[model samples]
Target chain A: MSGSSPGSIERLLGEREIVIACGPGGVGKTTTAAAAAAIAASRLGGDVLVLTVDPARRLADALGLKGLGNQVTPVPPEVFQAAGETPLGTLSAAMLDTKQSWDALIGEHAPDEATRDRILHNPLYQNITERFIQSHDYIAMERLYELHSSGSWDLIVVDTPPTRNALDFLDAPARLADFFSSRLLRWLIAPSRSTLLGIASKPFTQVADRILGTQFLADITEFFVSLQSMYDGFVERANAVSRLLADERTSFMVVSTSETVPLREAEFFATELATRGLDIGAVVLNKVLPTSLSDPDALAATRRLAQRTPEMTAALAARLDVDASVLDRVLETVTESFEDFAVVARREASSRERFPLGGATLLTVPQLDRDVHDMEGLLTLGSYLLGS
Target chain B: MIPLAERSLIFVTGKGGVGKTSVAAGLAQMLAFQGRSVLGCEVDAKGDLAAAFEAPPSGFTPVSAGENLSLMAMDTEASLREYLKLNLKIPIIGRIGPLARAFDFVATAAPGVKEILTVGKLCYEVRERHYDTVVVDASATGHIVGQLAAPQAINELVKVGLIRSQTDWMLDILSDPRQCGLVIVTTPEEMPVAETVELAAKVAEETTVELAAVVVNRVLPERFSPRAEAVFDRLSSHEGIDALSEVLGADSASVVGAAALATTMRRSRVQHMNTLRAGLPAGTPLVLVPYLFQRADGHRATRQLALHLAEEIDR
Candidate 1:
């Protein structure tokens, strides 16, 4: 094994009840989460569910499925055979349906059929459910908490939408709480309260009514009135998510690459997780360049190759019917090939310095020559992730 | 090549972590260098553009970045507030703090409201002639299509009211190919290339914006000679290790490994580049930006990328 044991990731998969994979977008967060969940299911002998927010066709392609819907799709035994791995336990995945989840949440939490119908049919609710800020994050957390408490799977792997920063997901519950508790909601629920305040505020309502227009204001007032009875249900759900995330069995796997911007985001995410006292299992750095060329002897070898530029040009000139001037350029290409490795080695060294992850076992996956387009690639990546 | 400099509003978006911010900044710099007053706006509210330029945070207001460049970090809340104050033209209680808070809460809950406000602000800036070129560093590809589509969606959804009137003007400029354009920035990798192809199709079908160009960032320059390939092929063989060791006067295994590693890097780059070229739409301009050996994070790196883009597009 390299420096970190292969069991580092495996430990998180087997021991923890919930594993959340998070990072900035395009760093292979979805692939990492899917692979780990699949390996844990097959190796650790437990039922695992991967809840992904991946785009429509991405998860299906990764899991080698025909198509994926919001419902759970189990990984078949044939897939394990195709991946060259033995199947043991069960593996299932579901892509989050943001709007559907919101609708279902309203149905589950509404005080009565009348209120539920009113809220569902409201133009504002219809619009908000589809495009609210971090609605995906908020609903995903709700779904994770719900599924976790249901005792359906031994381990649940949640993949978050790549937000502007990791803090958005961490801060989602509190932000939702704030939005729910704002004074505006109270006013919208009971506009009559404005008259109850004082005589000084009496004219304010008229001005607002005139500006927002009477119908729009009434629509806002009606929307809140219908949602007012369900406010406690929302607060309770949000609190449950917060408490679950802070629980001991819940673990977060921070994934990123050894690049400056991703490392910066990883640092921000890790630091925020630490501040929240959430357990960070490992910092999975993907697409890392090899550190071999940084050795002094390799550097000397590259320099030696560069020193033989004249002979290389002569040899290339003798081999091809080309002009003498083009031969030197071709020779530089040969010598500089070695120099390319040196450049990447130096860049990775500098990139490593910018990484903020500390104390947690750092797992590095070397850059693969090809993109993982199928289940075979996922299994290979999973082996690397599990340190096999 | 896409005539990006001529467009009033240029949207730069791609998959996350593909250096969209830097590409947007580099495009802004390139345009500014040509004497066009550029407003580099980041719509996701990450505000990394200010940091990339080594300037203080631009907040939600436009801050002068360089001689001809300006930067703004778009905040949906702030944009909503401005929309109410300016567009609604309400008299007295509209300017109150609680009203803005109320608007923010309701708008945040409403789906297209936030997007309309954000894109509405950008479109407003464009129509106002605020800058010669307004380059927006948009959010990830998944959300950006909806952001760009909001004006047209609202235009179709709400036929009357002040909202409809406001979105109508924005939609006119957005759907007009001359006024607005989109540039996709992606690495020469498999997933991003696949995503970019899908994105191009989606933007075409869902929105009025045009896909102006595709900037293939961080591409390795494959300049290997036949002799170099032959040498690498020999070093990869069993007996060639001893030959390479004799040639280098050092340990052959390490030298061979380095040579093979170099060859692998070049081969992968060629494969990715091929995937991108073959996959993207025909006749669409593909601008190849060389991979910077240094870290692509700082202002210097961004300016260097800008220079490369300037030369590539001109050619």
Candidate 2:
């Protein structure tokens, strides 16, 4: 969907069915996803769904989520109306419950009720779903695929997991596919015998048995053996998920703050997406200092006021009907604070100029003084996000 | 709450991108600069250790970072190999390849196999007195409790094994507050504060490790007193700006506006900080690290932050 066209985030949201919002953590990725989805539904007119990882408590309430679940809940129409936006379409939000999602996938792909019950009840099933780091990534991908294929929502914006490595979710599907087909996995599930394959896996089992104890090994073996029954279903679903990522109907919006660390990570992720021929719809930078702070004349005036604070305090105090001592302190702080922020603003401007966008549209949101919690706050952010 | 430098092992964790690595690096550097031999390990192995120190890349093997700081990344495979060499007395050179592959597979499949190795290595360093202190840039809050509780989880899962036998000492070290502690770093913001509070609760509930301190990083300076604040509020308006422009011969609105923004940001952050303090346990030492408007996330920032942390500690 992203090519040689006049592509803003508004167009990207309208055009693509899937928009993957991913970047370094703690940079408002989840909030941005929610905002983008809210804006799309309000402006572009569709049933937009935001699949967020973890939202702030108030934000969850704003979306009408009482507690955690995989159920997609619709944001009340009155919530949007309160924000002064009459949505043309419905907005829905779903928190990605990793454990429940894995259970649901097994429910869908299980060969029968007996196998499903066995796999679900197995102790290793709980451990693997909860402890396996990559399990969340794979399930997130699969859930997106399932939701898209079900034709439930017109647009889906996904807030990716906060992975230590940025590429984990992107590579999760192919990696899972390969893992399912791995020779080692096949060997693990095969019945023990004197066959050549069995003999090769014997030493591994013995070593593992010695280290982990035979009971744990047996538990692992039984779990995997049960999981082997659904191997064909998992691999086909994984492949489909991988294809969905690369499809033209999907787009990626890489998000980050203007801070050095998160921005650098985001640029690397953006570059990796392009290297893999993925469409980068837009590179959104959040919490950028306002450009007005960087005005040269403003910096000069602040310096002049700071230096002349003592001389002008009395007269200025009289004119403004304030105490001279308080005015003096206020003048000093005001000027010094302005100078301090100017340095940061100018530095941010330089980083903005230096960031490599390739061909993706660049969107920036200023550093709002207040935290975004309710729909009103989100709409305030969404206005900036839509570049209105 | 033991002082940061006094703890034999300190796991530094926070929400991602809140300067966790830099704070870890700063704590290690500060201790090392104080003439204590320190070992710093990056648990996630994201190469942030090297970035924070501006040093060469580190590996499982320790490399000299400065006067007394040795930096390395946490590699469970290497830790497993070392454990076998010490405990089992296995030569393990040629045999370790396939053995490590199998172990890696098991580690991937099992719940606490990999995490125990990470915690075990740090605990081993502490017990052996290889360094005065070991600083770990541990996983973020989401994964930290799981990582720190690895020994307990292992004890639950593995009833009998070499790994089971090793859990006793790791648990002892983790259970002793004087030996091991957790330092959580956060900026005064909504999500980070919420996560920090939750992590503190989880640590108390699940792990034996003590919450040593909460370091609030990137706190903006508040320059306006109540009276000065009232004075500035007037200056932020249209009529007051005209008066300021008459005095300075230039429109002071932008400067005044920028200052107002900074003040407003700090004011809102004060509310979040109050909520954070309330959610945390009473008497928990709250260290404030002032925001740096200059360079960021580099060696220079690390040094500046280290100095700021020292001043806070001294106070």
Q: Which candidate should be chosen as best, given lDDT against the real structure?
A: 2
Whole-structure CA lDDT of model 1: 0.76
Candidate 1: which docking quality band? acceptable
TM-score for the first chain in candidate 2 comes to 0.93
Give the Å error, residue B273, model 2. Answer: 1.0
The reply for model 2, stretches above 4 Å from the true place, is A1-7, A191-201
The 10 consecutive residues of candidate 2 chain A with the worst lDDT sum are: A192-201
Model 1 misplaced stretches (Cα beyond 4 Å):
A1-7, A55-59, A62-65, A112-114, A192-219, A309-331, B80-96, B157-159, B225-231, B252-281
Clashes of each: 3, 0
lDDT of 2 by residue, B52-123 (tens): 989887999999988899999999999988987888766687687778667856876788888999999999
For model 2, residues A88-154, the per-residue Cα lDDT tens digits are 9999998888899999889988999999999999877887788766788888888898889989899
TM-score of each: 0.90, 0.96
